[model samples]
Target chain A: MLSEAEIETLTGVAGLMIPASEAHGVPGADDSAIMSEIIVSAERTEDAVRNALAAFAEVGDSSFQQSHPDEAAVLQTIVASCYYRDARVLVSLGRKPQPPFPEGHEMEEGDFSLLDPVRARGEIWRKVD
Target chain B: MKTDPIDVLIVGAGASGAAVAWSLADTKMRIVCMDQGGTPDPTQFPANFMDWEERRNGPDHISPNIRKAPSDYPINDDGSPIKVVNYNGVGGGTVLFAGHFPRLHPSDFKVKTLDGVADDWPIDYQTLEPFFAINDRMMGVSGLPGDTAYPADRNNQMPPVPLGKSGEALAKGFNKLGWHWWPSDVAIATQPYDGRAQCINLGACLWGCAQGAKGSTDVTYWPHAKRAGVELWEHCRVSQILVGDDGMAEGVLYFDKDGVEHKAEAHVVIMAANGVGTPRLLLTSTSKQFPDGLANSSGLVGRNLMFHPYSFTEGVFDYPVDGARGPLKSIWSHEFYETDLDRDFVRGYMFEAARGRPPVNAALAGYEWGTLPWGEGHHDAFRKLNDRIMAFCAICEDLPELHNRVTLDPDQTDANGIPVPKVDYTLSENSKKMLEHSAARATDILNAAGATEVHAGYPIVYAGWHLLGTAKMGLDPETSVVNDWGRSHDVKNLFIVDGSVFVTSGGLNPTSTIQANALYVADQMKRRLANLFD
Candidate 1:
């Protein structure tokens, strides 16, 4: 579990990673619901998450992004994993928020005449007995 | 304890095992198949959950060492550059395959005769042509079949999958270059057939098809084999093949899910444990008669490993190609599939166009490549690449080398305490040359496709999907492990019907040919049953 102070620190960092976009109508990773999901997801790799957070805290949030790229990437992965799955974010990307099935998307059948050139090339395989 | 002896016993209920069992079901003889993995549940497939992308990178990973399911055995692949990827279940690798199905060309079967390279297969493309057609119908292949790259008479059971914007973009590139591109033959149901639903463009074929549209052998052949009275025992891991004093196979000793040991006796024992697992089992089953291994008089049970050396280049377009909208594999090019004496390499490669990555994967990949940044500009960078990138993989033909082998691990064992397989492999100079050439050609195609940016990576470390040629087939018992009909040379009642019997690892995916070889071997078994023991 994260203390209130750590959560606040994480919120600031998340906002820096992905700020709220008014034009796209999508909340930033710092949104409470998304942060809650990220915190929950952190439990899967608790040690690594804690280590990354500690590293960021030690470096201080202001210079963390500049001084520590590898540590920031750890937090980036955690945030992205949860943030991309959020309904608003998915919709902003023009994707359905729900699972891919039992309602799948339709695809357009492309033009087969695009292969006229290939077809005109004739048989290219070797003749073997 | 020993069970009653059956007419035939098959170890591993995977692609080849399922097909062989189904093909031999008409014989009316008592048959049994043992598989280590449990049956899959469609409701629990990753695509059914909102976190499908996360699951694909996690529990549903293609590498068994990473997935670590109870049925999966760990492979010690640290010594090799390429890692082995597999699914240890009823459907085997088919369960997680992208279903880009293609048959070996006629020239592939006679490599030694034409290219003066690896030994030629005892059987040719013509011999497996009928069987390939049979498998196509059974698997419900979908494609537009006048591909000039292959011989005449190649047909598809259904119309081709939608090319979508990504495929069309790549096809235009190939057309501009005057190269050979075709709608790839994929083992996915475009329309309803064989009791499966049509593909709904879930774009999650590699994580196990949630719609039951991909032709995994569990759905394609296991159902028919079971209906024909072929008993399938799941969660049963075979430890070794037991041989009688008369130098014949006497079934296998295996462990059930409970870790309890049991013995299954049979007149004939068929090994379909794939190239790695099959050789691992053979090397582990050492005895007084054979000494080295069962049916290993040629000392070639676990030698001559081959994997299609893989490379790819991704092109990023300004507009949305919607590359993640449909099946993973859409179109392919055979322009460089055949060998040319003028080239530096002996055999050639095929160019397979792949769909873009899922959103999460796309973001992660961008970060890895240092394109999508961490802070201020992450979203913009991601938007520019997501669904706008198209990738073309070069599946190069790797020649069989005796030094590249799968041997018994000196230390590690699986959860069931069975000795695990250790792989020792190195990329040959020929393969390296081929990968370099293919990457350059792929860049040309991507450039022709009007891409704003292109990135290429060679010798993909995670692409050991096509495991083959560890125990090859040939006419001479002194050189090969199995005979022309997949029968063992040293052990009369033993047979291997998997990729282990492949003499050459053709550039294309091997599942179609693997299943065809299995059906052909089954037919041969039936034709010579009266004199099979001779």
Candidate 2:
């Protein structure tokens, strides 16, 4: 949906939105694989993406960074949608790259002793006849 | 087209409709339920895909207006502070509910007697206690007994869902304040029960449970009701109730999936649509015998609409809370659930502790709130909030008001060309005060839980999950639409068994109580089978 120049501009904006971090071992939204997915998904929202790109080109990178307008929301949504679902991004967020079901995560059992104080207080509800 | 008359007809196939159908199935009466949406496909649930959060924000959104599925009917909620949120499928709202099942307090039935505000219910908690227990077993409820918030008879079929690190942190805060907090009773199965699998902590209960652990009516009551010989017709939108010459309900006129109109005749008709849908259908079903609407002789069919006004206070912690790893609802505090003269408000609210947001939702919320800017500091801001935040929602009890109502819109019509429901609602002074107090109290709890920062938003606009009190039940025919047994005061053979029959909105999730009421109404019908019309 985007030309080479527009793709380059989107990559720059995407990088600004979520920069690559070596400490977190996660790639930025501008990473080639993630950006490819974003471009593919942008087809579904072609008009919004084109409008956002036009706004970015008009404002320049510095001005666009200063002002996050309605157009920025479109880019942000597409970037975030692709960025968060990336395998490295999921791992960096401390989540498994897989879906929630069919292999759901395990949760620790609650400490029943936490209720001792509450149970000791007894019933707090009002009684009616 | 017209069909042969059946013994009983149900307009909706939701939580209440499924319960009523299952309860009456043993009577061997030819029962038929028609739902606009078909049974949900678990394979397509959001939890099954990597882009689940995207689906949740799109096609699987809670609001019918936003979801805009073929089965959904558009609701004109532009004038209301809180928008209407519901599902049109067989499970109804349960398809997207978090499964936090809490029963009404005994005092909830006698609000007028105790608090002198709303009218008391014709039947009290004692009358519905047995029915609550019956519904619990059928839905595979999981909870620990001996919650001091209710009578001692309360028990669940399985143990409670695990109160994860997030719940534990919130519990410690409640303990610090010496308040009443309990592991919430949930409709999700904790153990393998009734041929359903145990919960695997998918943390996606609200977006449709792919694990089949959550007890949505589709998995619980509908299967049993069908097994017991109840026939359910899906993708059929009921437009109006057909009135006979003698002023009794004869049947309903509905449009099927292909927009083919059909007349379904039944000796007895039941309206199990939600609060908004029920009144909308009634107001649109006008005739010469009833110039105003069907079963609306009292002129209260759409009045007294109540929604449990909700607010959220979230705390961002430094340590890992794993807030996105389990069921959405874990622990709840009833610290301010009852009325106290010391407070500014007459009625009170419950503090429901909720799990944190997923990655995509967290990013979007950060942008919407303007807390996380897009450039250099964005990553740092995201790290502080993602999977580390815990939230508490104040589910406040809303008093019934004459002005807050569901009226048929003159302009808007749904895909099936039926006039849509127009919601006109405003926050009452009492509800405003309650939200203010709840935000402060929730902040105190979050601060005590070792939070780095806390933020509060009152009257959450997208949190209109609980819709109630549009067609309330009472003894006086002049004041109420349905009787205590859910029988319509005007139309002898017509009944309403949904949340519309709730006299007052309690400070808890109403699905449990709604099912119990349906069961009670079914029991009453069975007892009065010989003289049902009397």
Candidate 3:
């Protein structure tokens, strides 16, 4: 479990990675409720985020946001993984965040015209007799 | 009271194990199938239908090393570039496979005679062709039948799934390039077949299908085999094969869900465990009778391990390509299936048309690739990378190098106190060259299709799905582990009917061939039922 301060900073980092743009209708890390989800759902992300923060502090002698290491990479994966999958973020990007089962997505019937050109030049088999 | 031995014992009721059991079901022999993992709970599938992407990194990851749920066992793959990605359930790897069912080229069987690099299979494609049709009927393939890329008389069970916008774009590009592209032959059914549901195009085939549409053996063969009176012991991991003084396998020693060990005896023991599990089971079953491991006198039990080295490329189109709508891979280009004298590599790779993953995977990938820019341009970058990307992977053919292998680790043991399989593998020159060529070709196709940007995963993180060649088949016992019919040369009553017996790793998803070989081996066993040990 991360300290409350670390969670806030990590949330802030997530915002930076995917900040809000009102013009593009995209939700930033702060706008979404994915931070808690990241902490709870990501595999060992809490430890990795804290370790990254410590590594950053030890390197830069300044707080977190210093020289990011492997731990930082792990944190970024966790943050981005949970954040982008959030329903709010997906909706803002004109996509559905829901899993594509039960009520499946609207898949347009394939345009058979795309295969017209392909069908013209058919049977390109290698002759190895 | 000790129980009497059954007629046959099959281990790991995944694709191959199920195929072998069903193939011999008509013989009216008592067959017992054992699996280390049990039936997937219906409650767990909704987690896939609900929190699909979020659950992947947490527990649904295909790799046992990452998805260390109760059903998985640890694998020490530190020695390899690509770690093992498989499951332990009744369906085996098919539980998580994309169900792309491309068959091995006829040329694949004659590698030594045609290519002169790897050893040739003792049996040719024609010998396995009938079984391929048989397995296709059983698995219910979905594809156009007359694609000249394969044999003219290919037996497609149903029309292929409809290609989405991304697939059409990729197809147009392949057409423009004058390449041989066709709708892939997948195991998923389009309509109801043999008591299973139809394809709903949910797009998460890689993460176990929740609709029970995809032809994973759990839904396909397990039901049929059970009805035919095959006894399947789920969540029972076999630790050792008990071979008597006569050097014939008597039965297996397995660990149950409660970590209790039990012995099941049978007249014949067939190890249908996959490439890694099969060799690990053999190497761990060492005794005074066969000091080097049962049927390992050839020392080829765990050697010559081959995982198809992969190269992935994606095209970023200006408009949204609704890639999130079909079977994971539908349209594939096999133009360069055979060797070209001008090419640097001996064998070639296949180009499979795939879509960008759902939002979560894409977001992670975009961040990792530095494509999803931060702070100010984040929105545009994420939008551009999200629904508009069409991705594809080049699955290259890997030849068997004796040094590339799976060995037993002495220190790391599973919950059952059996040695874990340690993989020692590296890319060969031929595979590297093939990948380089494939990546360049993929980039060309993407560019040809009027893409605005192109991104590629050079190492591709292709974590060894089509595991093959660990316990290969051959005519000579000194050179291989199993014979032509998958019968262990050292122990006649012992058989291996899985991808482990593949002499060569073909440039396609391996389940179809693995299943077909299972049918062939089962047929051979049935014909020789009177003299099975001979």
Candidate 4:
């Protein structure tokens, strides 16, 4: 249900966080349509908090749906939110979180081995904010 | 009125039943396994972890096992004579187990012999050691080896799950405190062993492991048995165990999925319907010869039920520590595993560093922010959730007493109109004492690990996980329904092979011990069969 851009971004983040290769032989974030599938299958649906943020692509850009008519900005927002939120959940479930850092600092540049941010970002997104 | 006959009839297809069936696979005798739940294809398991998260909210959250939908999934505690939490399909309790498998210590076997309290297990751990090793390999357990608490001959292979932060932190703290701890031995396959893939750290174990990394009998033992020519009847509820004039099980009467009665006769019947279900079935099957209940001559068929007291306490850590991302249990501490003279409790407690998946955390955080019924109050609660790190549960041992019992409710019945087991239970003085001691120690460990707020409590009333001791095994026929070999003392061919025959519950989870015991009994059953035929 998410917009193409938001889906792309979320998948991009999932790719970075989960990575294509890990201990479990790569549970790819990009291939995970789990959120989208769940949203479509719901008996009744509501706009989740994260979907609201997905309306703006990169802050300055118009909503992904407006720029690309075929896109589902609201859905993308919800999916991204749902995905990230679960990422946060993965954190609480006992995985160590990645260290927080300021923007444009090369998200992957930290000492990831000791402090895996993918799991942390996933935990933060899991929050209701 | 008429009875059909076979060699071995097994009930319930969970870990216990599956292991028993697997053990009996090589035998030429006809084997029939039955369960009251539908067999779900592994492919249909949910991919979304959020649905799993909501599942922890109990019946209120989105889960297929919601009480309104399935009669079997209900946590029936309606002031009945027996209260229990049971899963109705293939794999039984193994379907919902967190895969935390640990062997009950040798001291656990001789609790009475060593501690001067409770009844001693007729068979010691040494007698069951070979079976334990066999089951461990069959289940593909992943865990570190060489604990002094365990026998030297026991296998010590560790599972592939790298230790998580909580495990590391707790291990470090325990080392500093000189406490015994180890990476938990889990049924989850660490690597791609036995055709099952390794765990992806989905952190959603209780809702059922979709990845199949967490070993349940459905994936491990049952399929192999089925391949070797064992017939399985899913959604078939066994109602009565029919006995012959010679005091041997002649056959079993059960209702199929369509509510039609079907009879399967067996020379030897193994009751693996778990601690509660096994006793419930026995109590329901009252015959003319055994008037009180089938195999209830001692009046111990449904008595002496024991559920280990479970408690939880959490520690708060600085910064956002993502603790909800892997199998529920990754590590365990048995620092206080044995009886302690310094404490008032008879048995020790096992501490586990476990994961609480996201949706559960969200529900715990008190609903969504600014959403009606959940305003800023809820938002603030959600904000602080990430800073929590927890040393999850400490299972304290509870002694088997005659007073703590399970009985069939005359008024209540399952979908098939059979009486459900009503649980009439209370924490004995020893259990309460053990719980208090474990809670105090749990709080101390949390404080020592720099936890800001430590919360501790006893097992929620009727929160049944490890059902045990309903049909206990003992050397004394007057006190137990089954003998040391799990064969019924009263009936010649009926065997009780689940947790129901346990005289005492160790601080550890019951899955490994149950599976081991089942294998041992199955081996005995094979020998008995050869002797009868030859």
Q: Pick the candidate with the highest DockQ.
A: 2
**lDDT score at residue B313, model 1, on the 0-100 scale:** 92
Worst 10 residues of 4 chain B by lDDT: B367-376
In Å, candidate 2's interface RMSD is 1.6
How displaced is residue B418 in candidate 2, in Å?
0.7
The prediction achieving the highest lDDT against the true structure is 2
Please give, for residues B1-534, the per-residue lDDT of candidate 4 as tens digits.
Answer: 223356788988887899998889898567888888766454444334344333333432222224333427333455432245555678877776788888888778777767888888999887899999999988888876654445556564444355666565555555556565666788887778677877776665665667787788888887788898777878888999998888778879999878899888887889998888898889888898888889898999888888877776666555454356566776677767777687776777788777432433533322222111121232234435553556467887878888777787767676778886677777767777777777777777666666666566666443477899999998788988998888888887889899999989988799999999999999887777756322
Candidate 2 residue A40 Cα shift, in angstroms, is: 4.6
For residues B54-148, what per-residue lDDT tens digits would candidate 3 score against the true structure?
Answer: 67665788889888877788989988888789978989888888889999988888877877878889998888999999999988899877676
- The collision pairs in model 3 are none
lDDT values, one for every candidate: 0.89, 0.90, 0.81, 0.66
What's candidate 4's DockQ score?
Answer: 0.03
For model 4, what is the error of residue B453's alpha carbon versus the real structure, in angstroms, after optimal superposition? Answer: 2.6
Candidate 3 wrong stretches, greater than 4 Å: A25-27, A55-72, A112-129, B1-4, B46-50
**Can you tell me which runs of candidate 1 are displaced by over 4 Å?**
A1-12, A58-73, B1-4
Q: What fnat does each of the candidate structures reach?
A: 0.77, 0.80, 0.56, 0.00
Which scores greater on lDDT, model 1 or model 3? 1
Which interface RMSD values do the candidates have, in the order shown? 1.6, 1.6, 3.0, 17.9
Per-model chain A TM: 0.83, 0.80, 0.66, 0.29
In candidate 1, the residue pairs with backbone N, CA or C atoms under 3 Å apart (3 or more residues apart, or in different chains) clash, namely none
TM-score, prediction 2: 0.97
TM-score of chain A of 1: 0.83
| lDDT ranking, best first | 2, 1, 3, 4
DockQ of each: 0.68, 0.69, 0.50, 0.03
The CAPRI class of candidate 2 is medium
